[model samples]
Target: MGGLSDRFWNGAAAQLVNAIIAAVNARDFDALERYATADLLFCDSRGGQISGLARVIDWLRDVIAADPSFALQVDAVTSSNGSALVTGTTVSRFFPEARRTLWRLTFSGGRVSEWRRYSADPLPVPPPLTAH
Candidate 1:
């Protein structure tokens, strides 16, 4: 029964990752809050660690407002026993040189308890304009 429950949690955690991406893309901070625990910890790519929903909401709001083209793409997810890790890439127009970010999420009670993210690779530069 424990194994079955673990599997179920793993799947749910994976889905939560997608939900988070969608919320960010939509700039829906309120909806994103639904997936977080009260004491959630967020470790950003810039080496900043912030805790709690209000802080997270403020951070996300600032981020979204600063970069109108910010977008996230989930690449993969894995989970076991009350925790999950998600890998993904984030793209933003504001800092195009450092846009590709990989994220890892940890879950507890079907809510995100911790999130750590960093760039998996150097962000790509847009090609120079070509004469048509």
Candidate 2:
């Protein structure tokens, strides 16, 4: 938690991330219901922002049309308290480029309050500790 919010975020948050990812991959955004707060916010790496679930849905539909083959695969998840940093790859048959992606997610009351996509994975996971 790092003493951030009082909210508890861990495995459940990861699962929510995965579910959202799946919905995006399938282009079935209706599945995202109940996963986001009423005032959800979504932003792209380029600084474009979409507020509210309805706006987010419109933006996602546009994304799907522009990049039909774009897909995200989660490589790792680091979460604490109400925040999670997701590292993943985005590969598209249309683009044919393997790009590293970072998804920053914040949860509140078991639902996503904010989501941001970054073009790079900034925080590398540290090595595990050995017995002293």
Candidate 3:
């Protein structure tokens, strides 16, 4: 029974990842909206929060307008306890470099109720430690 449950969740999470990738690549705002709840909440690493589907759509549009070359390269997706954690790289046509980002999608009642994104800067190499 547990094995079946695990497979089921893994499949669902993969499906969700596929849907998101397709929607983003196609720039289909409707599909994105459908996958998310009406009162969806998106929180950025800076602690800024955007609530509601309409606002989220608007924000996404603005981002695309600012960076038309933006695309996602999903490295991995993992699901546990009804939430999916996506690790990926943010690729941009205009930018010369790719940025790393993590997305956490929380699902409820067949819709994503919350989405959190975390971005990071590459760490610098550490200096060699002296022998004691």
**Best model per lDDT:** 3
User: What TM-score do all the candidates reach, one by one?
Assistant: 0.77, 0.78, 0.84
What is the lDDT of every predicted structure here?
A: 0.70, 0.73, 0.76
Angstrom error of the Cα, residue 18, model 3: value is 2.0
Error of 3 at 114 (Å): 0.7
Ranking by TM-score: 3, 2, 1
- Per residue, candidate 1 scores C-alpha lDDT tens digits across 1-132 of 378887787778778888977987888877888988888887655446777878777777776666677678777888776666666666777554535556777777778888777764422232122233
The sequence of per-residue lDDT tens digits that candidate 2 reaches over residues 6-105 is 2345566778899988987888777876688878888666556667887777766765676677678998888886788999987765444678888899
In model 3, the runs with Cα more than 4 Å from the true position are: 93-95, 121-132
Candidate 1 has a TM-score of 0.77
Task: Write model 3 residue lDDT over 92-124, tens digit each, in one string.
Answer: 654468888898999988778998878754212
Error of 2 at 57 (Å): 1.0
Count of clashing pairs, candidate 1: 0
Of models 1 and 3, which has the larger TM-score? 3
Stretches off by above 4 angstroms in model 1 are 1-6, 95-100, 120-132
In model 3, which residue pairs have backbone atoms overlapping below 3 Å?
none
Candidate number that wins on lDDT, 2 or 3: 3
Better structure of 1 and 2 per lDDT: 2
